[model samples]
Target: MSFIQTLNDAWSRTQSLLCVGLDPEPAKFPAALNGRPDAIFEFCKTIVDATAPYASSFKPQIAYFAAHRAEDQLEALIAHIHEKHAGIPVILDAKRGDIGSTAEQYAKEAFERYKADAVTVNPYMGFDSIEPYLAHEGKGVIVLCRTSNAGGSDLQFLSTSDGKPLYQVVAQLAAQKWNDNGQLGLVVGATFPKEIETVRGIVGDMPLLIPGIGAQGGDVEATVRAGRTANGAGMLINSSRAIIYAGKGDDYAQAAAEAAKKTRDTINQYR
Candidate 1:
Protein backbone atom coordinates (compact mmCIF):
# COMPACT_ATOMS: atom_id res chain seq x y z
CA MET A 1 0.00 0.00 0.00
CA SER A 2 0.98 3.61 -0.46
CA PHE A 3 1.84 5.85 2.48
CA ILE A 4 -1.58 7.58 2.48
CA GLN A 5 -3.45 4.32 2.32
CA THR A 6 -1.26 2.77 4.99
CA LEU A 7 -1.79 5.76 7.27
CA ASN A 8 -5.56 5.74 6.67
CA ASP A 9 -5.81 2.03 7.35
CA ALA A 10 -3.82 2.41 10.57
CA TRP A 11 -6.05 5.28 11.66
CA SER A 12 -9.17 3.22 11.02
CA ARG A 13 -7.76 0.16 12.74
CA THR A 14 -6.55 2.07 15.81
CA GLN A 15 -9.37 4.65 15.87
CA SER A 16 -6.78 7.28 16.62
CA LEU A 17 -5.22 10.44 15.27
CA LEU A 18 -2.49 10.30 17.91
CA CYS A 19 1.13 9.82 16.78
CA VAL A 20 3.62 9.05 19.53
CA GLY A 21 7.08 10.53 19.00
CA LEU A 22 10.11 8.29 19.65
CA ASP A 23 12.60 10.99 20.64
CA PRO A 24 14.82 9.22 23.15
CA GLU A 25 16.84 11.66 25.20
CA PRO A 26 19.65 9.91 27.07
CA ALA A 27 19.50 11.95 30.26
CA LYS A 28 15.71 11.67 30.41
CA PHE A 29 15.62 7.89 30.01
CA PRO A 30 14.38 5.67 32.82
CA ALA A 31 17.04 5.17 35.51
CA ALA A 32 17.54 1.51 34.68
CA LEU A 33 17.86 2.16 30.95
CA ASN A 34 20.00 5.29 31.18
CA GLY A 35 23.71 5.28 30.28
CA ARG A 36 23.40 1.96 28.46
CA PRO A 37 24.87 1.76 24.96
CA ASP A 38 21.57 0.49 23.62
CA ALA A 39 19.39 2.79 25.71
CA ILE A 40 17.97 4.78 22.80
CA PHE A 41 16.88 1.77 20.79
CA GLU A 42 15.57 -0.07 23.82
CA PHE A 43 13.56 2.94 24.95
CA CYS A 44 12.18 3.56 21.45
CA LYS A 45 11.22 -0.08 20.97
CA THR A 46 9.40 -0.02 24.29
CA ILE A 47 7.54 3.17 23.33
CA VAL A 48 6.55 1.73 19.94
CA ASP A 49 5.31 -1.52 21.48
CA ALA A 50 3.39 0.34 24.17
CA THR A 51 1.83 2.98 21.94
CA ALA A 52 1.17 0.81 18.89
CA PRO A 53 -2.32 -0.09 20.10
CA TYR A 54 -3.32 3.57 20.42
CA ALA A 55 -1.21 5.21 17.70
CA SER A 56 -2.01 5.67 14.04
CA SER A 57 1.68 6.37 13.48
CA PHE A 58 5.07 6.68 15.20
CA LYS A 59 7.47 9.57 14.50
CA PRO A 60 11.16 9.20 15.41
CA GLN A 61 13.02 12.48 15.39
CA ILE A 62 16.30 11.66 13.60
CA ALA A 63 18.45 14.19 15.46
CA TYR A 64 18.23 12.19 18.68
CA PHE A 65 19.54 9.05 16.99
CA ALA A 66 22.18 11.00 15.06
CA ALA A 67 23.40 12.73 18.21
CA HIS A 68 24.09 9.35 19.81
CA ARG A 69 25.45 7.93 16.50
CA ALA A 70 22.71 5.30 16.72
CA GLU A 71 21.53 5.22 13.10
CA ASP A 72 21.68 1.41 13.20
CA GLN A 73 19.32 1.42 16.17
CA LEU A 74 16.92 3.71 14.29
CA GLU A 75 16.93 1.28 11.39
CA ALA A 76 16.24 -1.59 13.80
CA LEU A 77 13.43 0.35 15.44
CA ILE A 78 11.69 1.07 12.12
CA ALA A 79 12.09 -2.52 11.02
CA HIS A 80 10.69 -3.69 14.34
CA ILE A 81 7.63 -1.45 13.98
CA HIS A 82 6.99 -2.77 10.46
CA GLU A 83 7.43 -6.36 11.53
CA LYS A 84 5.40 -6.11 14.72
CA HIS A 85 2.86 -3.31 14.34
CA ALA A 86 1.99 -4.06 10.68
CA GLY A 87 -0.03 -1.01 9.60
CA ILE A 88 1.28 1.75 11.81
CA PRO A 89 3.18 4.24 9.63
CA VAL A 90 6.66 5.30 10.78
CA ILE A 91 7.59 8.88 9.89
CA LEU A 92 11.28 9.75 10.15
CA ASP A 93 11.22 13.34 11.29
CA ALA A 94 14.46 14.33 9.64
CA LYS A 95 13.40 17.71 8.18
CA ARG A 96 16.07 17.36 5.48
CA GLY A 97 16.56 19.66 2.49
CA ASP A 98 19.39 20.25 0.02
CA ILE A 99 20.18 20.62 -3.67
CA GLY A 100 19.87 17.93 -6.38
CA SER A 101 22.16 14.98 -5.58
CA THR A 102 22.26 15.75 -1.89
CA ALA A 103 18.45 15.82 -1.79
CA GLU A 104 18.41 12.49 -3.63
CA GLN A 105 20.78 11.01 -1.05
CA TYR A 106 18.61 12.33 1.78
CA ALA A 107 15.59 10.68 0.17
CA LYS A 108 17.52 7.44 -0.06
CA GLU A 109 18.50 7.67 3.60
CA ALA A 110 14.90 8.22 4.64
CA PHE A 111 13.21 5.61 2.42
CA GLU A 112 15.92 3.08 1.54
CA ARG A 113 18.41 3.18 4.42
CA TYR A 114 15.99 3.60 7.33
CA LYS A 115 12.82 2.47 5.54
CA ALA A 116 10.57 5.16 6.97
CA ASP A 117 7.05 5.12 5.53
CA ALA A 118 7.03 8.92 5.50
CA VAL A 119 9.44 11.76 6.22
CA THR A 120 9.35 15.40 7.21
CA VAL A 121 11.21 17.72 4.76
CA ASN A 122 12.36 21.29 5.00
CA PRO A 123 11.10 23.39 2.03
CA TYR A 124 13.19 26.49 2.58
CA MET A 125 15.18 25.82 -0.58
CA GLY A 126 12.00 25.69 -2.72
CA PHE A 127 10.48 22.94 -4.91
CA ASP A 128 13.73 21.45 -6.20
CA SER A 129 14.72 20.50 -2.69
CA ILE A 130 11.37 18.70 -2.21
CA GLU A 131 11.01 17.06 -5.64
CA PRO A 132 13.50 14.27 -5.03
CA TYR A 133 11.51 12.92 -2.09
CA LEU A 134 8.29 13.18 -4.11
CA ALA A 135 9.84 10.98 -6.80
CA HIS A 136 10.03 8.06 -4.32
CA GLU A 137 6.61 6.83 -5.58
CA GLY A 138 4.62 5.51 -2.58
CA LYS A 139 6.50 7.13 0.27
CA GLY A 140 5.14 10.34 1.78
CA VAL A 141 6.82 13.76 1.45
CA ILE A 142 5.58 15.96 4.29
CA VAL A 143 6.82 19.48 3.59
CA LEU A 144 7.30 21.77 6.54
CA CYS A 145 4.63 24.46 6.45
CA ARG A 146 3.91 25.98 9.85
CA THR A 147 6.27 24.63 12.47
CA SER A 148 5.68 24.46 16.25
CA ASN A 149 8.83 26.07 17.62
CA ALA A 150 8.69 29.63 18.99
CA GLY A 151 11.00 31.00 16.29
CA GLY A 152 9.06 29.46 13.37
CA SER A 153 7.11 32.66 12.80
CA ASP A 154 10.33 34.37 11.78
CA LEU A 155 9.95 32.89 8.29
CA GLN A 156 6.65 31.00 8.03
CA PHE A 157 4.35 33.90 8.86
CA LEU A 158 5.90 36.38 6.42
CA SER A 159 3.43 37.86 3.91
CA THR A 160 3.92 37.42 0.18
CA SER A 161 2.97 39.82 -2.63
CA ASP A 162 -0.51 38.36 -2.68
CA GLY A 163 -0.82 39.10 1.05
CA LYS A 164 -0.93 35.38 1.92
CA PRO A 165 1.44 34.11 4.61
CA LEU A 166 4.36 32.02 3.39
CA TYR A 167 2.86 28.97 5.07
CA GLN A 168 -0.37 29.33 3.11
CA VAL A 169 1.69 29.62 -0.05
CA VAL A 170 3.49 26.44 0.90
CA ALA A 171 0.14 24.74 1.44
CA GLN A 172 -1.04 25.94 -1.97
CA LEU A 173 2.12 24.70 -3.66
CA ALA A 174 1.96 21.35 -1.83
CA ALA A 175 -1.66 20.72 -2.72
CA GLN A 176 -1.71 22.20 -6.21
CA LYS A 177 1.79 21.63 -7.51
CA TRP A 178 3.85 19.00 -5.66
CA ASN A 179 1.21 16.35 -4.98
CA ASP A 180 1.47 14.48 -8.24
CA ASN A 181 1.40 10.96 -6.72
CA GLY A 182 -1.19 11.59 -4.01
CA GLN A 183 1.58 11.26 -1.40
CA LEU A 184 2.16 14.85 -0.32
CA GLY A 185 1.33 16.14 3.16
CA LEU A 186 1.99 19.18 5.36
CA VAL A 187 3.53 19.73 8.79
CA VAL A 188 1.34 22.21 10.61
CA GLY A 189 2.05 22.64 14.28
CA ALA A 190 -0.80 22.09 16.74
CA THR A 191 0.54 25.03 18.77
CA PHE A 192 -1.09 27.45 16.34
CA PRO A 193 -4.71 26.49 15.74
CA LYS A 194 -5.43 29.54 13.63
CA GLU A 195 -2.48 28.80 11.41
CA ILE A 196 -3.63 25.18 11.22
CA GLU A 197 -7.07 26.33 10.15
CA THR A 198 -5.57 28.62 7.53
CA VAL A 199 -3.47 25.86 6.06
CA ARG A 200 -6.40 23.44 6.21
CA GLY A 201 -8.48 25.88 4.24
CA ILE A 202 -5.80 26.00 1.55
CA VAL A 203 -5.04 22.29 1.42
CA GLY A 204 -8.50 20.85 2.09
CA ASP A 205 -8.15 17.13 2.97
CA MET A 206 -4.37 16.81 2.69
CA PRO A 207 -2.76 15.02 5.62
CA LEU A 208 -1.25 17.22 8.32
CA LEU A 209 1.42 15.95 10.71
CA ILE A 210 0.81 18.20 13.70
CA PRO A 211 3.23 18.38 16.60
CA GLY A 212 3.69 20.59 19.72
CA ILE A 213 0.99 19.05 21.86
CA GLY A 214 1.52 17.77 25.44
CA ALA A 215 5.05 18.94 26.28
CA GLN A 216 4.71 22.07 24.13
CA GLY A 217 1.26 22.86 25.55
CA GLY A 218 -0.75 22.89 22.28
CA ASP A 219 -4.43 22.89 23.17
CA VAL A 220 -6.03 19.60 22.18
CA GLU A 221 -9.51 21.07 21.88
CA ALA A 222 -8.32 23.93 19.75
CA THR A 223 -6.24 21.63 17.60
CA VAL A 224 -9.15 19.29 16.93
CA ARG A 225 -11.47 22.20 16.30
CA ALA A 226 -9.08 23.81 13.81
CA GLY A 227 -7.15 21.01 12.17
CA ARG A 228 -9.74 18.28 11.56
CA THR A 229 -10.67 17.77 7.91
CA ALA A 230 -14.21 17.52 6.62
CA ASN A 231 -13.92 13.74 7.13
CA GLY A 232 -12.35 14.23 10.56
CA ALA A 233 -9.18 12.37 9.69
CA GLY A 234 -6.48 14.67 8.39
CA MET A 235 -4.54 15.57 11.52
CA LEU A 236 -1.87 13.49 13.28
CA ILE A 237 -1.41 15.02 16.73
CA ASN A 238 1.99 14.19 18.23
CA SER A 239 3.33 14.15 21.80
CA SER A 240 6.88 13.17 22.75
CA ARG A 241 8.20 13.71 26.25
CA ALA A 242 4.76 13.78 27.81
CA ILE A 243 4.09 10.27 26.52
CA ILE A 244 7.49 8.54 26.29
CA TYR A 245 8.86 9.99 29.51
CA ALA A 246 5.67 9.70 31.48
CA GLY A 247 7.55 7.64 34.04
CA LYS A 248 11.19 7.02 34.96
CA GLY A 249 10.67 3.60 36.51
CA ASP A 250 10.67 0.02 35.27
CA ASP A 251 6.99 0.50 34.47
CA TYR A 252 7.76 3.34 32.10
CA ALA A 253 6.42 1.46 29.12
CA GLN A 254 3.11 0.91 30.84
CA ALA A 255 2.98 4.57 31.81
CA ALA A 256 3.76 5.51 28.20
CA ALA A 257 0.98 3.23 27.00
CA GLU A 258 -1.46 4.86 29.37
CA ALA A 259 -0.33 8.27 28.20
CA ALA A 260 -0.78 7.25 24.56
CA LYS A 261 -4.24 5.85 25.28
CA LYS A 262 -5.24 9.03 27.09
CA THR A 263 -3.89 11.22 24.30
CA ARG A 264 -5.71 9.15 21.71
CA ASP A 265 -8.96 9.27 23.70
CA THR A 266 -8.67 12.98 24.32
CA ILE A 267 -8.17 13.65 20.58
CA ASN A 268 -11.10 11.38 19.73
CA GLN A 269 -13.29 13.17 22.28
CA TYR A 270 -13.09 16.34 20.23
CA ARG A 271 -13.26 14.62 16.88
Candidate 2:
Protein backbone atom coordinates (compact mmCIF):
# COMPACT_ATOMS: atom_id res chain seq x y z
CA MET A 1 0.00 0.00 0.00
CA SER A 2 1.02 3.59 -0.51
CA PHE A 3 2.09 5.99 2.20
CA ILE A 4 -1.24 7.87 2.17
CA GLN A 5 -3.18 4.64 2.29
CA THR A 6 -1.14 3.34 5.23
CA LEU A 7 -1.59 6.57 7.18
CA ASN A 8 -5.28 6.71 6.37
CA ASP A 9 -5.66 3.20 7.68
CA ALA A 10 -3.77 4.07 10.85
CA TRP A 11 -5.89 7.15 11.59
CA SER A 12 -9.14 5.33 10.93
CA ARG A 13 -8.29 2.12 12.75
CA THR A 14 -6.80 3.74 15.85
CA GLN A 15 -9.45 6.48 16.13
CA SER A 16 -6.72 8.80 17.22
CA LEU A 17 -4.72 11.82 16.13
CA LEU A 18 -1.87 10.79 18.38
CA CYS A 19 1.56 9.89 17.00
CA VAL A 20 3.65 8.38 19.79
CA GLY A 21 7.32 9.27 19.68
CA LEU A 22 9.29 6.16 20.62
CA ASP A 23 12.37 8.15 21.55
CA PRO A 24 13.61 5.98 24.37
CA GLU A 25 16.15 8.11 26.16
CA PRO A 26 18.60 5.70 27.82
CA ALA A 27 18.04 6.98 31.34
CA LYS A 28 14.26 6.88 31.01
CA PHE A 29 13.89 3.15 30.34
CA PRO A 30 12.80 0.83 33.12
CA ALA A 31 15.67 -0.55 35.16
CA ALA A 32 15.07 -4.02 33.75
CA LEU A 33 15.55 -2.78 30.18
CA ASN A 34 18.23 -0.16 30.84
CA GLY A 35 21.60 -1.95 31.14
CA ARG A 36 20.90 -4.78 28.75
CA PRO A 37 22.60 -4.95 25.35
CA ASP A 38 19.37 -4.41 23.43
CA ALA A 39 17.50 -2.33 25.99
CA ILE A 40 16.65 0.35 23.48
CA PHE A 41 14.94 -2.11 21.18
CA GLU A 42 13.27 -3.85 24.13
CA PHE A 43 11.87 -0.59 25.44
CA CYS A 44 10.65 0.34 21.98
CA LYS A 45 8.93 -3.02 21.49
CA THR A 46 7.19 -2.77 24.85
CA ILE A 47 5.85 0.67 23.98
CA VAL A 48 4.68 -0.45 20.55
CA ASP A 49 2.92 -3.50 21.96
CA ALA A 50 1.22 -1.40 24.63
CA THR A 51 0.22 1.69 22.64
CA ALA A 52 0.06 0.62 18.99
CA PRO A 53 -3.68 0.20 19.23
CA TYR A 54 -4.07 3.72 20.58
CA ALA A 55 -1.55 5.59 18.45
CA SER A 56 -1.94 6.44 14.79
CA SER A 57 1.77 6.15 14.09
CA PHE A 58 5.20 5.82 15.74
CA LYS A 59 8.11 8.17 15.13
CA PRO A 60 11.67 7.56 16.31
CA GLN A 61 14.09 10.42 16.04
CA ILE A 62 17.34 9.15 14.51
CA ALA A 63 19.60 11.11 16.82
CA TYR A 64 18.34 9.22 19.85
CA PHE A 65 19.31 5.94 18.21
CA ALA A 66 22.50 7.27 16.67
CA ALA A 67 23.89 7.92 20.12
CA HIS A 68 26.42 5.26 21.18
CA ARG A 69 26.63 3.75 17.67
CA ALA A 70 23.26 2.12 18.11
CA GLU A 71 22.14 2.34 14.49
CA ASP A 72 22.08 -1.45 14.18
CA GLN A 73 19.98 -1.71 17.31
CA LEU A 74 17.64 0.98 16.05
CA GLU A 75 17.23 -0.83 12.75
CA ALA A 76 16.43 -4.01 14.63
CA LEU A 77 13.86 -2.14 16.68
CA ILE A 78 12.23 -0.78 13.54
CA ALA A 79 12.05 -4.25 12.02
CA HIS A 80 10.54 -5.67 15.20
CA ILE A 81 7.86 -2.99 15.32
CA HIS A 82 6.97 -3.53 11.68
CA GLU A 83 6.90 -7.27 12.21
CA LYS A 84 4.60 -7.05 15.21
CA HIS A 85 2.38 -4.19 14.09
CA ALA A 86 2.10 -4.86 10.40
CA GLY A 87 -0.47 -2.13 9.85
CA ILE A 88 1.06 0.56 12.02
CA PRO A 89 2.83 3.22 10.00
CA VAL A 90 6.23 4.32 11.26
CA ILE A 91 7.75 7.73 10.61
CA LEU A 92 11.53 8.03 10.98
CA ASP A 93 11.99 11.54 12.33
CA ALA A 94 15.43 12.18 10.94
CA LYS A 95 15.47 15.75 9.68
CA ARG A 96 17.99 15.09 6.90
CA GLY A 97 18.74 17.09 3.76
CA ASP A 98 21.84 17.73 1.74
CA ILE A 99 23.18 17.50 -1.84
CA GLY A 100 21.37 15.13 -4.20
CA SER A 101 23.58 12.05 -3.85
CA THR A 102 23.96 12.27 -0.11
CA ALA A 103 20.22 12.74 0.25
CA GLU A 104 19.74 9.63 -1.86
CA GLN A 105 21.94 7.62 0.52
CA TYR A 106 20.00 8.92 3.51
CA ALA A 107 16.77 7.94 1.82
CA LYS A 108 18.11 4.44 1.24
CA GLU A 109 19.20 4.14 4.86
CA ALA A 110 15.83 5.22 6.20
CA PHE A 111 13.62 3.52 3.62
CA GLU A 112 15.48 0.38 2.51
CA ARG A 113 17.35 -0.27 5.71
CA TYR A 114 14.75 0.70 8.29
CA LYS A 115 11.58 0.32 6.17
CA ALA A 116 10.06 3.56 7.41
CA ASP A 117 6.76 4.70 5.99
CA ALA A 118 7.83 8.32 6.17
CA VAL A 119 10.97 10.37 6.79
CA THR A 120 11.23 14.00 7.77
CA VAL A 121 13.46 16.22 5.55
CA ASN A 122 15.00 19.63 5.96
CA PRO A 123 14.22 21.79 2.88
CA TYR A 124 16.88 24.44 3.41
CA MET A 125 19.09 22.55 0.93
CA GLY A 126 16.64 23.29 -1.91
CA PHE A 127 14.21 21.10 -3.87
CA ASP A 128 16.99 19.09 -5.49
CA SER A 129 17.89 17.78 -2.08
CA ILE A 130 14.26 16.73 -1.48
CA GLU A 131 13.83 15.11 -4.91
CA PRO A 132 16.02 12.14 -4.02
CA TYR A 133 13.76 11.33 -1.09
CA LEU A 134 10.73 11.40 -3.37
CA ALA A 135 12.14 8.50 -5.39
CA HIS A 136 11.12 6.06 -2.67
CA GLU A 137 7.75 4.66 -3.70
CA GLY A 138 4.90 5.10 -1.23
CA LYS A 139 7.12 6.92 1.24
CA GLY A 140 6.27 10.26 2.83
CA VAL A 141 8.63 13.21 2.77
CA ILE A 142 7.87 15.65 5.60
CA VAL A 143 9.60 19.02 5.39
CA LEU A 144 10.48 21.10 8.39
CA CYS A 145 8.70 24.39 7.88
CA ARG A 146 8.47 25.86 11.36
CA THR A 147 9.88 24.40 14.57
CA SER A 148 8.95 24.87 18.25
CA ASN A 149 12.35 25.66 19.68
CA ALA A 150 13.09 29.03 21.25
CA GLY A 151 15.71 29.78 18.61
CA GLY A 152 13.38 28.97 15.68
CA SER A 153 12.44 32.65 15.37
CA ASP A 154 16.01 33.47 14.40
CA LEU A 155 15.08 32.40 10.85
CA GLN A 156 11.53 31.07 10.59
CA PHE A 157 9.71 34.23 11.65
CA LEU A 158 11.79 36.61 9.59
CA SER A 159 10.02 38.11 6.59
CA THR A 160 11.26 37.29 3.14
CA SER A 161 11.69 39.74 0.31
CA ASP A 162 8.08 39.04 -0.66
CA GLY A 163 6.92 40.00 2.86
CA LYS A 164 6.12 36.45 3.96
CA PRO A 165 7.80 34.55 6.75
CA LEU A 166 10.34 31.93 5.72
CA TYR A 167 8.08 29.18 6.98
CA GLN A 168 5.21 30.43 4.83
CA VAL A 169 7.45 30.24 1.81
CA VAL A 170 8.53 26.69 2.70
CA ALA A 171 4.92 25.59 3.12
CA GLN A 172 3.87 27.11 -0.19
CA LEU A 173 6.76 25.51 -1.98
CA ALA A 174 6.13 22.09 -0.49
CA ALA A 175 2.35 22.13 -0.78
CA GLN A 176 1.84 24.02 -4.03
CA LYS A 177 5.06 23.24 -5.81
CA TRP A 178 5.98 19.70 -4.76
CA ASN A 179 3.02 17.78 -3.31
CA ASP A 180 2.11 15.33 -6.05
CA ASN A 181 2.52 11.81 -4.69
CA GLY A 182 0.15 12.30 -1.75
CA GLN A 183 3.22 11.72 0.44
CA LEU A 184 4.26 15.27 1.27
CA GLY A 185 3.73 16.96 4.65
CA LEU A 186 4.97 19.80 6.82
CA VAL A 187 6.24 19.74 10.40
CA VAL A 188 4.36 22.56 12.09
CA GLY A 189 5.16 22.82 15.76
CA ALA A 190 2.14 23.28 18.05
CA THR A 191 3.94 25.76 20.30
CA PHE A 192 2.88 28.58 17.97
CA PRO A 193 -0.89 28.37 17.73
CA LYS A 194 -1.27 31.35 15.43
CA GLU A 195 1.53 30.18 13.18
CA ILE A 196 -0.07 26.74 12.98
CA GLU A 197 -3.26 28.30 11.66
CA THR A 198 -1.30 30.35 9.18
CA VAL A 199 0.49 27.21 7.99
CA ARG A 200 -2.87 25.46 7.60
CA GLY A 201 -3.87 28.20 5.20
CA ILE A 202 -0.82 27.64 3.03
CA VAL A 203 -1.12 23.86 3.16
CA GLY A 204 -4.80 23.56 2.30
CA ASP A 205 -5.45 19.83 2.85
CA MET A 206 -1.93 18.45 3.29
CA PRO A 207 -1.01 16.37 6.34
CA LEU A 208 0.86 18.11 9.17
CA LEU A 209 3.23 16.44 11.65
CA ILE A 210 2.82 18.57 14.73
CA PRO A 211 5.18 18.21 17.67
CA GLY A 212 5.34 20.08 21.02
CA ILE A 213 1.82 19.13 22.07
CA GLY A 214 2.97 17.66 25.38
CA ALA A 215 5.95 18.40 27.60
CA GLN A 216 6.68 21.41 25.39
CA GLY A 217 3.84 23.52 26.86
CA GLY A 218 1.67 23.68 23.70
CA ASP A 219 -2.04 24.38 24.22
CA VAL A 220 -4.11 21.36 23.26
CA GLU A 221 -7.28 23.21 22.27
CA ALA A 222 -5.55 25.95 20.33
CA THR A 223 -3.37 23.50 18.44
CA VAL A 224 -6.31 21.34 17.43
CA ARG A 225 -8.30 24.37 16.37
CA ALA A 226 -5.41 25.65 14.30
CA GLY A 227 -3.86 22.42 13.06
CA ARG A 228 -6.72 20.19 11.93
CA THR A 229 -7.77 20.23 8.31
CA ALA A 230 -11.35 20.71 7.14
CA ASN A 231 -11.94 16.98 7.68
CA GLY A 232 -11.18 17.45 11.42
CA ALA A 233 -7.90 15.49 11.17
CA GLY A 234 -4.54 15.66 9.37
CA MET A 235 -2.37 16.79 12.22
CA LEU A 236 -0.20 14.26 14.10
CA ILE A 237 0.20 15.36 17.74
CA ASN A 238 3.41 13.83 19.10
CA SER A 239 4.33 13.18 22.75
CA SER A 240 7.67 11.55 23.54
CA ARG A 241 8.93 11.81 27.10
CA ALA A 242 5.49 12.51 28.45
CA ILE A 243 4.15 9.16 27.32
CA ILE A 244 7.15 6.81 27.16
CA TYR A 245 8.43 7.85 30.56
CA ALA A 246 5.11 8.20 32.32
CA GLY A 247 6.18 5.55 34.83
CA LYS A 248 9.67 4.23 35.47
CA GLY A 249 8.76 0.98 37.20
CA ASP A 250 7.02 -2.27 36.23
CA ASP A 251 3.77 -0.39 35.52
CA TYR A 252 5.43 1.66 32.78
CA ALA A 253 3.37 0.15 29.98
CA GLN A 254 0.11 0.90 31.74
CA ALA A 255 1.21 4.43 32.50
CA ALA A 256 2.27 4.91 28.90
CA ALA A 257 -1.08 3.66 27.64
CA GLU A 258 -2.90 5.98 30.03
CA ALA A 259 -0.85 8.88 28.82
CA ALA A 260 -1.57 8.03 25.18
CA LYS A 261 -5.29 7.67 25.85
CA LYS A 262 -5.38 10.92 27.77
CA THR A 263 -3.63 12.75 24.96
CA ARG A 264 -6.07 11.24 22.47
CA ASP A 265 -9.11 12.21 24.54
CA THR A 266 -7.84 15.74 25.05
CA ILE A 267 -7.29 16.16 21.31
CA ASN A 268 -10.77 14.83 20.62
CA GLN A 269 -12.27 17.51 22.82
CA TYR A 270 -11.40 20.10 20.18
CA ARG A 271 -11.83 17.86 17.16
In order, candidate lDDTs are 0.91, 0.88
lDDT of 1: 0.91
Q: How does model 2 score by TM-score?
A: 0.97
Clashing pairs in 2: none
Q: lDDT by residue for model 2 over 215-262, one digit each (tens)?
A: 888899999999887778888888888899988898999999999999
lDDT of 2 at 49: 85
RMSD of candidate 2 to true structure, Å? 1.1
Clashing pairs in 1: none
Q: Output the worst ten-in-a-row residue range by lDDT, candidate 2.
A: 26-35
Q: 87, model 1: CA deviation in Å?
A: 0.7
Candidate 2 Cα errors over 4 Å, as ranges:
none
